[model samples]
Target: MIPPDNQIYIIIFSTIFLGGLMSTFVVAMVFIHRQRQAQSRQKMDQMQVEFEKTLRHVENEIHQETLTQIGRDLHDNIGQLLSLTKLNLNSSKPEKHLEARECVNEAIKEVRALSKTLNLDWVESLSLDEYIAQQLQRIQATGFCETSLQSDRSFAELKKEEKLVLIRVVQECLNNAIKHAQPDRIAIRISKNGRARHIEIEDNGQGFDTSKQSNGSGMYNLSKRMETIGGKFSLSSAVGKGTLVNLELPFSV
Candidate 1:
């Protein structure tokens, strides 16, 4: 009952319709791919913002903790010295009064020493050996754990950022070692191999599985900070073998 011309027209229309459908599907796939790419970019931007915010937050927290400890040391440790000085000043004998003056001078010296630590600019300028010595002295005073430092070359030639990162990394490692590992001895070593600067913090303490949540936020932050500065971070630890945190930073000069 169909005419030949009409049947030919039907076939032509069907072909055109299928071609349009395929074109539409191709366009839709392109749109989907672009959308996914945009989403991925947004996620990366958000993560960068969050990481920076977290770093600032943690830095402020560390500053506050340091201030609090300094306050306690001044009060409990130095305050007693002040009290003794006052007692000597109130003595009935002249010799005792002279002794009190000497005591006062000693206390003032101690206060000055404590005051220097309020600002870490000196640390930025100090050699790695000197910085480590100061850190070790402070750590020893806390009776938390013993620390040692060994270096093949002086850290005076290193960049300021490198020194700060190095100190922060070691501080985080030592903190974790004391708080989590409860270590008896912590050792820090630094050396240069060709153009690479190598640093290591090792502790003989109760270690945890590195594959798990062993390092915590402090260590994680340090790792991220190191990566930002073109450095490599690695950690090795076991239940009884203790922990070893290592960092390698490329040196141009």
Candidate 2:
């Protein structure tokens, strides 16, 4: 049997030990919480950096494409009109001068139209369906292939960044079809399925094996870009069957 004084001392020691243990536990929990918060912040910062990088890349690509289109129009359309205007002006006939004035007016209009496309604001103003239709029309105008667009026109509005990324991806797909597929017919379909928007670009060209590794990084890069935008990209192809690209994006509520 312990004496009363000894009992008091034991109780006090036990109380002090328990209090110290609780303090250590609380400190450990707080440290763990703060460490997790720091990690979360770091991850979010890294994501923002990557998104900015992608945005810059998309902007550059769009600018380059705009320049190329402008160059083509200048050489093919505007230049020809100017040459005709010069020829008409050189003629002695006053009627030819009137014709020359008409040509100049037409050239002015074309220039104004081309100027609108030069600005990135057009990207924001154009809907995805409209852009796809325009692209198909351009291809058809080239007589490269028979192009078709089928759309339910139920596309949700997207942020400028999201729209830009989507436009580039679609452009890349179309280019790949023209360059590699050599398909006689290219068809694009846009639709909405439940909570997602779906686009399928299909080519009736020579398709490659999906199981085999691609010789280039184009396919891999496309997949990654879609992931960055919270979208999904899938390519299905088989020998002699042709290639189809499926793009899916969730509708933000």
Candidate 3:
């Protein structure tokens, strides 16, 4: 109903307004997308930092343990050889000489045992199950626990880093029970279900509330370690029901 000139002006204004709105929407979306990408990158960087820290800590501890083991082996095995040699020098009879030679052979046998016991190459190459069994055997020698292991041998499939973390977790937990809980009995059971491996360490000791009681760094470290590897950890305990630690690790599809 209006003049042709006015109608043209109205059309022009409408077109400009629509164009401005579309442009603004696109700019806003672009900004949001960039922000999201930056946040994701920051999260990834943080995780990497944490993982590296854990790896370094584990490596340091392993190095220290290896040194201690080697020292013990030398002192217990090779040191005895030196002692026997000195003892033989004190005796001059033919029978004494033969006995000294026999002692040397025994010492040589012990050196072989040392080589078998201190083999770190197996630690690096073995499966998780094998590593764990070896550890438990060492622990069991203390008459501390009725430990048992059942596995699909999938542990060897784990990366070296993963196996190290897992080993540390088990060692820490067992140590805590022995040092603090004074538990009379302990049991460890491991198994794999499909792509996930499960661990249950139960102790019949004086239990505490994991939420209220302060476990200091050990408990916190255990939880954080599991989380880093796409794993879950749970602790359940009562005043007298004892403590049970459960862990689960899931693999990427």
Candidate 4:
């Protein structure tokens, strides 16, 4: 057997070895935890950057659309009014002068209205359903196709970024339907499905096969955009049957 002094030394060495081993393990675990935290932070930063890029794109598209609408209004509505006002002012009759004044006033009001749409503030001011209704009404006014919005309940309020993304997606869907579908009627229905809200845009136009890959990147971009906003995009179409596009958003999101 070993001497008493040697046995005490052995016991001290064993305890020190075990303590050192535990210290190394704890250090390793802490390093792993900190590394994972850094990775998570990096991922969050990337997502935030992507979301900001999407918001910029949405803002640009909305500005372009607003400018186009303003151009149309100026050419078709305000321009005519100003011309009428000039003609009435040139006339000798006092009644004609009064009509000219009225036309000028109406034109001023229209200009004021158009000016309000020049900024991105409208995106935050308007609700989703209200915007949808306005879009459908604008389409119906064009007489290109019959458009309808059917909603029994209001949708959940979304953040400004989510609203912008959703509006852009909806606009793209309507544009595709009008440009390619050649449908007689386009119907947008909004409904609440349990914990989610659904917006369905259906057109009675010539539908293409969904199984075949699309040559355009529009659908893929739409899906990505929806995913960014914690939403889902679904499209169904057949060769002879009509096409339907559905957008779903969870209430918790």
- The lDDT values for all models are 0.77, 0.91, 0.78, 0.91
lDDT of 4 by residue, 1-253 (tens): 9999999999999999999999999999999999999999999999999988988988899889889989999999899999999999999999999999999999999999999999988888888888898888888888889998899654647888888988999999999998999998999999988888899999999999888957889999999999888999999999878899999988863
In terms of TM-score, which candidate is strongest? Answer: 2
- Lowest lDDT sum, 10 consecutive residues, model 2, at 153-162
RMSD of each: 5.5, 2.0, 3.1, 2.7
TM-score, model 2 to reference? 0.91
Model 4: pairs clashing at backbone N, Cα or C within 3 Å: none
- Per-residue alpha-carbon lDDT of candidate 3 for residues 38-87, written as tens digits (9 for 90 to 100): 99999999999999898788767766676776687688667887688668
lDDT of 1 by residue, 64-149 (tens): 65688689878987888788888988889899888888878888887887787676665565787776777777887788888888
Better of 3 and 4 by lDDT: 4
lDDT score, candidate 4, position 224: 92
- In candidate 3, which residue pairs get closer than 3 Å at backbone N, Cα or C atoms, i.e. clash? 127-156, 128-155
Residue 223 displacement (Å), model 3: 1.0
lDDT of 2 by residue, 134-240 (tens): 98998999999999999987664787888888999999999999999989999999998988898899999999888885678898888878888899999899989
Worst 10 contiguous positions by lDDT, candidate 4: 152-161
